[model samples]
Target: MKLKKIGNVEANYSFWQVLVVCSGQEFLDSGEDLIASFEINSPDVRLVLCLTDDLLAARELLKSLAQKLIALSMYELELDGDVDDNQRALPYQIARNVLLQTRLPTLLLESCSFVRRDITLLPAELQKADCALKLRFNRKGISQKVLTNTLWLLPNSRVDRFLAQAISGMAKTTSENEERKAVYKALQACRGFLKVAALPGRYADRSHKHEGFIWVRLPKEKAETTAAREFREKTRARFARPPEVIILHPKQDLGTKSHLENNTFKRRVERLARPGRIAWRQMARLLVELSWERGKPARLVPLPQWKITKEALKNYEFAKTIFVPHLISAQLPHPKAYYYMQELVPMLFTVDRNGWGGVDSI
Candidate 1:
């Protein structure tokens, strides 16, 4: 902190300008860790949370958070693809949208990341470069060629004048080629932010020079073998297991109702709740059948919509749900995290066409 005499009045400020983009609730717990670590040590650091896909949805949930110790702010960025609209995927959208955000020296991190040590060292290193890149890989070891989207840092000098449109344009093509291409595209964006070099107007060959990226290997998520086994047993015992289930999202299903009021809105809610009610109806049938066949109570599995389909998911995760990280894997912990979420937060009980647990619900 510093104080300067401006004419007669005194002014105060911190030594460094720091910004962090914490996106998604899957990372909110880890976000808390970032906040506590940064705020306690550096009182002047500014933290920003970026919530994508839905603005009203995120606002509703965030307002419910009662942690007074926490202090932060948010900006809603719509980062999702529309197949019917034939739109570009999120990565490109992210590249384009991020260009317009703050022009200060900034540090970007995902919801999965936690500050392992003092972050002061990170800023010091980043100050040397126009842009610094970091990525996490899924493989056992780290590779520069294969990059994961996790973090980026940039100083204000370059960001104040970077070409937003070009970086976003490159992302469009990069996302289409392959995973390696996507990695290359992000690198290009960093360079653009620094004004070191701008990508050519025309798309180039698959290969490109690797620049300032520093690969950091993160610890693998926790194990959930027992959770999966228990879930399987419960599913088999009660309902013979479902084939597939669709987890509806408000932005995709109920966005049309965003402007409705009174009776119009009520009608949309009833219409949207149809799917959840139907799933409950199926559960009811399965319960009755199990009661007759087993002569006693049988363990009911997660609602059909809650079943985990992706073999890669941990802790019986449903990808789109807030439980993806904390509740799905033993890795993340939160106030009303994972399976216990609905018990503490009533909004999580249902996800459907209408916004109940959704953002616009309130």
Candidate 2:
């Protein structure tokens, strides 16, 4: 897999600088008999393997096919990986652990429903995973000490089978070693974005142990404690662990599960969802308005409560809660012009753009 530049070919934001990808292999065994497994060797790390749901049906079909091949003096058996690699299938081991363990059930509960005072629906079966490993897409890039803080956010249900097929195609051509390396790189990059942290400078020989931080964002409109973030914070507050937030967007009403429509719709929505950007613009404006009301050029200003615009209410189904932290930084050069630009959520620990690096300590 290679990290490719995607979205907004002419966009100027620093966040849009990179995107990484890896081939997903499950598509090759789609609709066929397959078994996925995961191994929980460490209490800190849990690896999961997913397999085809039609394992029984594939077994039956294979039996009949095998008999016909045997009569032709060409006995054959379909196998997942090479005999050597099969002996070390991590996903298969992980799958078995998931089936036999009670912890999986507990974990599944969190993923069952997207619940909130305002946002009622969310994605299901989202998993939280953490791992520390050396990652690199190309030799030229630095391999800093890397950590993976992962949550399987909402699925693009529309791209289900087509995504599977795409993965299968990639798997057929790419070497397993190369694929693994590529996936590790992509995951590391994703984690860095969510945490507002830096990537590793180099690969470490020892297995990097990562930590999992999962929960929904706190809705600003509702009472703050009822938010998903509060629950996670309560659990790990004593340890002062770093936070990772994943915002999921679930499928609204489409019926088809194949990737074709999902990808098509995803592309269409990305174009139409300029509201997300617009919302930020409004936030920036609100901050400026508040600053002016204070009668000073303040370094920070609170974003005023947003009014639900009629145009936005017509298209979006879910209620959005715009959160403005105590600090605000206008990316625009002139403080006066900052009011016109879009505003991003301030980092948890950052007072402003200059102190963003200090966020982890808080």
Across 40-158, the per-residue lDDT of candidate 2 in tens digits comes to 00011111222223355544543443222100111111224422223122322222233233122111111111111111011111112122223334454322222222222122222
* Cα RMSD, model 2: 21.0
Give each model's clash number.
4, 21
User: Best candidate, lDDT-wise?
Assistant: 1
lDDT of 1 by residue, 1-362 (tens): 11111111011111223333333554444444343333222222344444443445444543333122221222333334421121223332343244344334444444443332223223333334544443333444323433333333343435433323333434434332353344455455555445332221111101111221211223346342464335324433423322122111121112232433432323433533454433433433343344436554322222213222243233223222322211322333322222321223323343222222223223
Worst 10 residues of 2 by lDDT: 35-44
TM-score of each: 0.36, 0.19
The runs of at least 3 residues in candidate 1 whose Cα sits more than 4 Å from the true structure, single-residue gaps closed, are 1-44, 55-58, 64-67, 70-101, 135-150, 155-180, 185-362
